[model samples]
Target: MSASPWLVGPFVDMLVGSGLAYLMTLPLLLIISVRTGFVGWPVLLVTLISILVSVPHYGATLLRVYEERSQRQRYALFAYYLTGILALVFLAGIYSIPIGSALLTLYVSWSPWHIGGQNYGVALTILRRRGVEVTPLVKRLLYVSFVLSFLLALLSIHVENSNHVPASGLQAARIYRVIPVGIPSALVSVVFPVVLMIYVGSVVGAFVGLVRRGVRGWPLVSVVSLVAAQALWFVVPALLFFWSGTDAEGLLPFAAIWISAAHSAQYLWITTHYARRIDPGIRTGTYLGKALLAGAFVTIFPGLLFLPDWLGAPSWAAGLGTLLFAVVNIHHFALDGAIWKLRDGHVARALLRDDPGLAAGKAEASVGLGRWGWRVVWIGGSIALAVTVHEQFERTVTLSGITLRSLDRARDAIARLEWTGRDSDSDHLVLANSYLQAGNPDAAEKEYRESLARRPSAEAVSGLAAVRIQRRDWSGALENYDRAQRLDPDNVDLMIRRSDLLNQLESETPPVDRAAIRDLQRRSIRLLERALDLDRRRVPTIVRLARVYTRSGRRRDAAALIQAALEGLEGLASTERAMLEREKRALSDPRSGSAAGTRAGPVRPGASGARP
Candidate 1:
């Protein structure tokens, strides 16, 4: 009951966070006709994969229906879940992946809230299994978590709304990915084992009914152990030194390798144990174990790629973990659970024995080299994971330009903070600034897509329109600009950019409608006029109108506008003034021509015959 508050709080918060992410795509939702359409593909894929891999447990048992030759029927969800997870695992194993991995990673590695959500689901399942009613505390905490997640989502949305983002540099996203890799190799190896113990301990506690037994007794003792162990991973492990000890920073790789191997062995061992006596009678136990193991390797690993490095994490440890799980599942849990049903409780009796109850009969077990073989497999898997990591970061694309680094830095920063207490709008604003600075149109565009996914904000639409402008995607720019204008009609920059795009498009249309051309010209003038109205000292507004006049065929008006803008540049340096003078001359000269030799064209129908 005491732990209930912590569990429910994060769980509810995660669900609420997910819901906010879901709702934030409201614009995209409107377009797609599904409220959660934007995030659905990845989430559904992960769920499907998780569910699929879980079935082999069932298959293993069903095989014993005693007829290896008989046709077999398997549920579809099992396959789907397995597929999703395996897909992710394959992604982690490679140096690079196909486009699908990129999209899938976003859903799988979205935030800690997602991981917390999964944990909550597991916790709730536990509550149901024991037929325990959630006390008022659990309910209250759940509501709190919901509020927290909602608030975070709101914060994320707010961050995404800002425009002062970096347009080029180390995208913050990529930076997040790199940090964990460098997590002082000394501590790397100890993390998984420590974490694993806690997870397993929690599972055991559940079985022992410590959770049901309330706080302060034998259960509390176990809970205390679990909490202390878990804290060491996140906090500086001052006490674990007695056991895990210290290592030189350079020795981290070997440690990581060892750690990975240990987990792999553990998971596999547990899985096999679970499968062995997992009677053909029931459907869940063994299959669920296998499915979850596969999910660990596939979905979890692959999903990390989408995570910014900070939260991204390495998978060799998880891979090692999967193996470790197999051992515990089969030998420790499954075999034990099955033994529970025996009339005399044979399985429990065997587990209690140090001599290996129901030991593999001497000849059948062939003890020769068996233990060593497992040791080898465990070590090998860890080595493989390390190798995979070595390959993933073999090259760096930054250090070449400030723009790239700035963008990368910002992306990592935003991704790291996305789940804490922010909404999509705020997250997008942060992501947008990074993307904009990075000169990465795709990243910027993604923020826009994210914006459209949730609630449509004037800022988000405008940011998207600006991204469109950078990409030279005039049509999209125009569309987003229009939406932004409707949301914030009096915004000066939006009007100017929108008018500029329209004018540019009008020029490109061959045999364009004279009425439309005239309308655009008038619109351009009005927008410039509006900008000046918003801020009378705006020189850029003056220059922009001059360009409009030139485009519209009024050379005299264009010249006068240029002179006006120049008058405000008295404080500019000599070189700057000279630059401005040359620009003014170029605009005023009829033959000052654009594109090397071509003369400026007439702006509209029936104007001075300079359409050439």
Candidate 2:
């Protein structure tokens, strides 16, 4: 007997299998909403979706592997040995950022390909079910199109966002601190467009081939929808990044959230179908309940058990979670690949046809646990899930408050988190930044010290420097700034800040002490020149350097710098352009002297004068 053309009919298959047409458009719309300030609860929403949809999908794979004794024995190497290895890796990753980042890199690199592979399998299954002969040429064409799509998306992510660092709170940005994997912009400029064109052409060729081979109706719709979803997920965003010449930091998180949710739902839809068909006695709810629990157990429970102390530290938690996530996904990818091959006679018989031959061997009897023992197990699982959910809820509130800039709400959430013993270095740093923004330099300094005590990062030291600047402890501020620069020598912002401080000190020096003033100017000049060397397009650095040149009696050099800035005026913001024009006028007027860019007093940290 032939297998049904549709799994649970056309509507369900199209909605779940193709992951709904809206799945393609929703990410773009949501990203726009977030960017425009229309959405404020994105973190909360994505977290909930992850708990409900994404986590359970991982459970589906576990159920497929260990639910039956015979299946467990068949895949023992993966189900037991490989899982044990991944567990050890996870433990190591909690302490070592490099190991954790390597694990994350593997998962990130493989994620798109895994999505493409699944879609490719589904499209082929649909075609076969519709009675279309899938020739080797047709298979090759489809395979190439999907692979190209994944490559296009992957390249776009690395290329377009190469220079854009996300907010410090984000997981990607945190990992990038240890492992910088950004591709060069010049290479992205050359390669992305070529790959995009080839991907588009391959997709079109595949569609035409399918049509020529008598593919029609739901099968064609499914294939077309899958291709469109791939494009929406990967290609369109890349195109947007390429066209706008902006970072994808705003869009990437939303895209990842929705795409993962959609992918998980699609996986569950097919896997559940397979499970029910292969074992007629299995109820859908029972199978899904087990899958959900198993998924939560593998993904969440282990983290809680092994890294209880690290949960409060967002940096450590994020890294550990990333490592755990990578391990689970790698295992899922490997096991799913092994079990779901259409080339396997048993898999083909079970999925492509309603054949019970695959289930002829009886499943091993359940462990003879008494009712009380079963009840205890369920109770323990429930408590674990409840704890996980509550932790997630607190995290969501804190992250939401941060994203929305609701300082009061953020403070309250942070307090609650710390009250629960979840206080972390990152949390303290965030509090310090909040205090700084609120103009409480003393409080900000205290928080910064607290953060540094837990973990000494450049950001924390920089925050302390800013606090000292606010208190007018110039020598103390310089000390902290020097420490910060030592931690991050290549940071252009730090170079500019230190230069600005020197310029302020020069303005304070008595005119009679020309040598001392000149020495300060020279030091400032060297710092600005170094900043310019690091980033030639940094207009602020160029403008600042020109001001120093005018003060140092290099009127010709200053005028030339101002002229170069004006030549690229179109790229400058209106304020930047106005500043440059004023500098040009000052350079032309010999009587203007040091009035053009000299600060009368110390510029506040993050003020226009400090940066400009």
Residue 398: error of model 2 in Å? Answer: 6.4
Q: 1-612, model 2: which lDDT tens digit per residue?
A: 345777667777888887664565676666677678553335557667776778788888977777666677788898889889987887677666777767766666667788889988888877776788877877887888889877765765466344322211235334423233677878877887888787777788888888898888778888888888777666676676677865554555455666777788888888888887777788878877777777777766665555334453333343445566677888888888777888977667766775767556557524333456445445655655775666567676555456425666666665665443444568778878877877878777788887776567888998988887777766677677779889899988988888888877777788888899888889888888888888877777787898888788787888887797688545777887887777787777767764455442366764111543
User: How high is the CA lDDT of each candidate model?
Assistant: 0.40, 0.71
TM-score: model 1 vs. ground truth: 0.30
Q: Pick the candidate with the highest lDDT.
A: 2
> In model 2, which range of ten residues has the least summed lDDT?
163-172
After TM-score superposition, what is the CA distance of residue 260 in candidate 2 from its true location, in Å? Answer: 1.8
lDDT of 1 by residue, 1-612 (tens): 222322223443222211222223333434553433332223223323323433233223322221112211122232234335544554453333232233222322232232233223333433432334555554344334433332222222122221111111111121011111123334534543454454445445443453553534322332333223222211222123223443211212222222222222222332343334333233445444434433333322333333322443322222222322222222222222232221233322222111232334212221332556434433543443343333222212221123545666645544443332122344555566556655666787787676555445677777777676676676777788788889888887777676667666666655446677767777878878888878755555565676666666776787776676578645666665565566587875667531112222222211010011
Best by TM-score: 2
lDDT of 1: 0.40
lDDT of 1 at 594: 17
